[model samples]
Target chain A: MEAALPESARGGVAKPSSEADARRRRAFIYGLIAFLLVASLPFLPVNNYIIAAVVRALIFISLGQAWNVVAGIGGLLSLGHGVFLGIGCYTTGILFNQYGIPPWLGVWVGAVLSLLVALVMGSMTLRMRGVFFALATVAASLAMVQISRHFVDLTGGADGLALKFFGNSWWAAQSRTPAPFLYASLAFVTLYYWITRWILNSKLGLEMQAVRDDEVAAAAAGVAVFRTKMLGLLVSAAMTALAAGLYMQFYMAIDPEAAFGLSQAIQLQLPALIGGLGTAWGPIIGGAVMIFLSEVTNWGGTKIGVSGVDILVYGLMLLVVVLYAPKGIVGSVLRNAMKGADR
Target chain B: MNAPAVALEVRNIARNFGGVVALRDVTFSVREGEVVGLIGPNGAGKSTLFEIVSGNIRPSGGRVAYFGRDCTTMASHLRRRAGMCRTFQKVRLFESMTVRQNISVAASQCLPKGRDLGEEVNNILAQMRLEHQAERRPSELTLADRKRVEIGRAIAGHCRLLMLDESLSGLTHDEAEHLIDEIMQLNRARGITVIVVEHVLSVLAAMVQRLVVLHNATVIADGTPSEVAHDPVVIEAYLGTKQKALR
Candidate 1:
């Protein structure tokens, strides 16, 4: 807000003032430049597949960064956060299909519903700890999926809901171009990235991290742990929901299983888990890596004569990364770089 | 001791943990800028009293008033905002963060809004003599340094009343002396009230202006160090006269 820390001190732990302030400012400028570059990539010579893959990666980055707000900073390991995404996607899909609401406005409907779901989920699971909290989130998400399926009249049930871009409105859901969708995803992800960065630098973000590091110590320091966790969950759910709305436009179909599935939940973690949960660029790096791995696995599938080879590759890579670098790739790399700098 | 203002006051407080009575009818007042020592053997309810006064463990009975306001049922954060902060008996720090970051967390998170956190934090670091080790993490510090960081963090808050729970438990004699000097400066120069709970009698005697002796969940003695030091019950509690006489 007040410029930020010094450029040279960017990766180093923040000092009270002086050099760190300059680094913070420089880092912010760098972030803005990076966002602009990524946003302009769809207009470049990249293939449609490459552009689409980048868009998907950006969407994952947004969701991962959102998840970090609650899981990394707030210390709430919500394993079933895909429920918010599912709610968002379905809300937008249903609105666009049944009520002729444009996808642009539908995103808001999805975001609001996700926020409500987060409020209810947070109120129930925010008090639980460790494995209990994780399990509770999974169970709650599972229940939401079941409910969506049971209401087959509104949702297409297991058959899924197809969204046709027939509505009039230049900025609404009528466009068939992947370029706009890519740009849209990039813009949303960039906005989320900056927002999360701002939040991490704010008082609320610090309080959330305090709760994460040590709840008892944070309480002694006067941090309201429950309130911080709730706020983190609300913000996280809203962001995930927005990403889900964008995703519906990209895929053009939504079903309870595809939207709220455990695989989707796992996909949400790939970015953060691989990048470093709380680090600013962790989500982007993790998202890029996952996207690259999927592309590679797809090419390798023809040689290996296997269609679902991507999941196997992902599983093995994650296992290796976790075993060798429990802090994730970006976290380990940053730690090493800092160590080198200190030396 | 500076007679600046009333730092903390407790009126008829009681606490229960399930069926266990942690404290019963505990009432006392702490003066401004005085290092009041609270001492008891293990399971004597000293820690419980500290928790209640610090707003960690809510008292099941009675009110805790600080700086002329009733904070008996106030949330810990509100009390912290009201300039009441404390450190744990065991060291608890942001293990993933470096020492300076841990102290900075207290500054950014606990200090009142718009406070000149940079200057205040720098002053605290200088006072604690922790400037050189700022870049190091909590896990890398020695037992004494880790404890100092924990104390430094509490001191960095907007603190009128500073509560320490066995902060010097594992410190060497030299380290303890250095820390005691800092604690004294916090009171004498800044008018910060201190409630130090410790099992170390000699250090407690040298540091505190007044003494509160607790035993079996109640206040057993309250007075100056010299006066309370010679009390029959105080000596008996500390030395275990029956056991010492038989030996």
Candidate 2:
């Protein structure tokens, strides 16, 4: 019966049995462990500074996971993702300040607006490849910054907008301490991570990856190359906007430079690149490593009375990561481990 | 009995690149279930014709029809969905994916809702005799195996007409013969129309019911294998000044 099969059809090499299942099970276990650790963070007698760092790390995880969808999976490296974040921040801020809208409701509005911007940006830039696409996105972000600056009456110009203190109202997303904000960040990051995982395992994800591999071949295989790339950008933009809305509520202020600066884009992308570009767990691990390193450097630099020493150290750390683990730490480590197991 | 329907029709097709004339006023058609061989020397516009028919490039002038429906302006993917599938001369496969995945991805495109994609892929793998290497990537396969994967991918779709471009170019004589037999079996069993562009005369003669020869961008001969072999123009084209030796 097998001999009658075409040479291409003959089952010769044995596939690793239950490998996907085993990996899923392992992921579930790790996720549960991480969730428990986060859930218990408030119960521990941690200092306020420690809690603040954890909240910042959670925010990066959200941003990195969102970036992974567009750059890592869709293969469109967007250097202007910060524009969506700024849009989210400004949308929530303006609505709350002028219309008396609650941040809870305003964030959703911000997300929808960000998605619209993403659609326009993706349509314009997705046609370009590699460096051209990246440059287009950077141009888009810079344009947003200028727009925000020019509309001084609406955006408070360079002075920025500060959220009014509403006496720890959950509806307003205003709280006195870092604990509630930490939990909120934790929830958002967890949701984004699961969403990333679900997408990675779906048929759509397979199509996205097929397009990433070869657009011409993918089109021949009936995958809509442009549509898939746009979908990735939309999803990524929405998630990044959500993170930005949360960041505004937590920090209680936003300025064009703080929200739409080039550094904001770098901050979102660095975690994903340092951890792993495409993997679900990459952003979380990378975000934690980045936040911890930054904190350590900041503390050491202040003790030594050097104002710019922390940024120099941060740059050095990134250079080392790029040199040694070009695939990102998590990706390289997992690859080597898989190879060892195969051996 | 009714005559078999024309599966593909190429009418007055012409293509040009600036000053270079790749094809001019070329026309041919393949009937349903017929195996037609397209043969020409290097730079004969064989590949360009395939590209035009497959919707990869728009013909400068002409119309392509499938089953009497004009599809000259249809997109390549839409053409594939309309039951026209083709393989490339340079065996292109998704190198990152396994052989099974490469076939499955293409096959899944034409499948109607509720069809089992895995089953379709497995059938193609078995038909192409690629089951043994199903888990291997295209990079891991030999040139012959990679070519098989490409052919397998084309056939896995709802292929009413399969256009093969130099599919037997890089294979050993034995390997070529084996592939030719498989192609014959596919045509016989599935009643699929085939248009093969090949440089191997022996393989071309053995497989095709009719031959269409192109030289200097125009059809020089079109007939059965024996008729084409005996055609004076074809002899002159192939032999050049060596036509005296044949005489």
Candidate 3:
């Protein structure tokens, strides 16, 4: 027997759940359309420069979204995320270059190592609130950078580690063109976005948001505060580590300065912070916007024959955003939409 | 008549901050389904005692048991799972969430798995008379409504022992009385044990069956409202030499 659709057919106003369902449907359609466009980019005869920019944007979204699980949702802002990235890059690069292992298996080893580091770091630092935790993570990241530089034999020291490239070898996860890397990065971004949304809707997400709002109150309401923070840290660490393999594959090399430096650490937070800290789409939008702005500015600077001019403009734009739109682009939009709903 | 089982027992609880004593040898037990008032002047260790009982802080010396099980060293969240819930002197609500989400967070954690969480949240909304303000954030609601949401969140869980810490301080006289009625109904209708800490004597007296008074960091009186009201020690502790001077 066919079941009848449940709504009264006469009423125009929808229930909250129905409204949410409609929104979800609209979002899925939009996402599908957007995915198709991105997937068709490499075939549209676009320049490699543009394709490479999009690829960098996707990696930022993937990494930033993972960091958001810890800093935004779990309310534990960590400044040492670069250590996990470095660990993955170094671990995968070392395993593959020295031991003749494939990066496909090597990334998992990096994930395990990152997990161990996160467990140790989270236990000691998650108890510290706000700036102190950030400081601790910064110290840890600096220590990892020094460690990477000091190990000349394993990491190639200042010069960094490079993969033994066999051009367009699928087994080596190497590619000569940006197209394959773009597709891989696209898949990574897509998986990251879906996983983020799933986590936001899960029970763990509820507990994490609770702790983020008020830890004492969350505890009073029966949430394990420390455990929740640790879980968030672990998940963030493993995911960041997982994405590092692709980063190494795309770049073909990873130096300590590029992998574990403060600049790289700050880069990780930009997408989520500028998009909408805890929202799933925040990083995706922020990543795309940032990459587009950077590419345009960089190209303009080259035309003007001036170096570092783009950086000054980028800083100015970011400063404006931090001062005026403290909630980030997506977060401000959401807040305004909520206000309209109330009205 | 059968006696009610003891739901919470505190024995010889003491706390000291450096050289200053906050509480000294304070002991009390709440019977199941009974409403008790914890009254004390400022600096009389009421807050400290509440913290110890709620597992926010450990007493320098003493024991706390919940429903015949020792919970002296249990984490605050674990204690909550064992049916111990508390509110803050200043309302501690999730400011980012709607009133519905605030209560739903607790209900989701405390309710048995497979139960309809949406139905449970709706029931709590109805029970607390928060249906109209369910979609409003704590910052958007009135002070009374915020207090109601705090209480609602505390009791939404598997709460057998509900402790409210000065939850009615800032409300208007009518609002306080109405909240008192709802709190009493929670005890009488829902059969939950309650311990309320309030500075307002008339309000607390009306809602509670018995009062435990703290003075000079120790229990000075424990009796019915009328009995405690007449006790000379409680009178002296609260009023001191200024009792006749102010009048």
Candidate 3: which stretches are off by over 4 Å?
A1-23, A309-314, A334-343, B239-247
Q: Residue B191, candidate 3: how far off, in angstroms?
A: 0.8
User: What is the interface RMSD, in angstroms, for predicted model 2?
Assistant: 5.2
RMSD of each: 3.9, 4.8, 4.4
Q: Report the C-alpha lDDT of model 2 over B1-247, residue by residue, as the tens digit.
A: 9999999998999999998999999988889999999998899999899889888789999899999999999888888877788888888787756787777667767766676666788788888898888888899999889988988888776778988999998899889988998888889988889999988776788789999999999899889987888888988896353333223
How many clashes in each candidate? Answer: 15, 21, 0
lDDT tens per residue, model 3, B1-247 = 9999999999999999999999999999999998999988899999999989999889999899998998999999888877799999999998876787788778777877676666777777888898888877799999899999999999885789999999989999889888988888888888989999988777777778899999889998899888887778877777454233123
Model 1 chain B weakest lDDT span, ten residues long: B238-247
Scored by Cα lDDT, where does model 3 land?
Answer: 0.83
Candidate 3: the clashing residue pairs are none
What C-alpha lDDT values do all the predictions have?
A: 0.78, 0.81, 0.83
lDDT for B245 in candidate 3 is 15
Off by over 4 Å in 1: A1-46, A127-132, A167-177, A338-343, B1-5, B109-114, B241-247
The Cα RMSD in angstroms, rounded to one decimal, for candidate 2 relative to the true structure is 4.8
- For model 1, residues B45-154, the per-residue Cα lDDT tens digits are 99889888877788888888898888888878778767788988888998876676677667665666666666666677777888878778788889888888888888
Question: Largest lDDT belongs to which candidate?
Answer: 3
- The digit string of per-residue lDDT tens for model 2 on A1-343 reads 0012222322221244566446546667877898888778889888888988999999988988999999887778888889888988999999998889988888889999999988888788786655877888899888988899888877888888887789789778888888898989999888988788666655566666677777766766766677888888989999999898889988888888888898888888988888887777778888898888888988888898977664566577679878998767777866644321210
What is candidate 3's lDDT per residue for A170-240, written digit by digit as tens? Answer: 88899888889888989998898877766665667767888999999999999888888889889999999
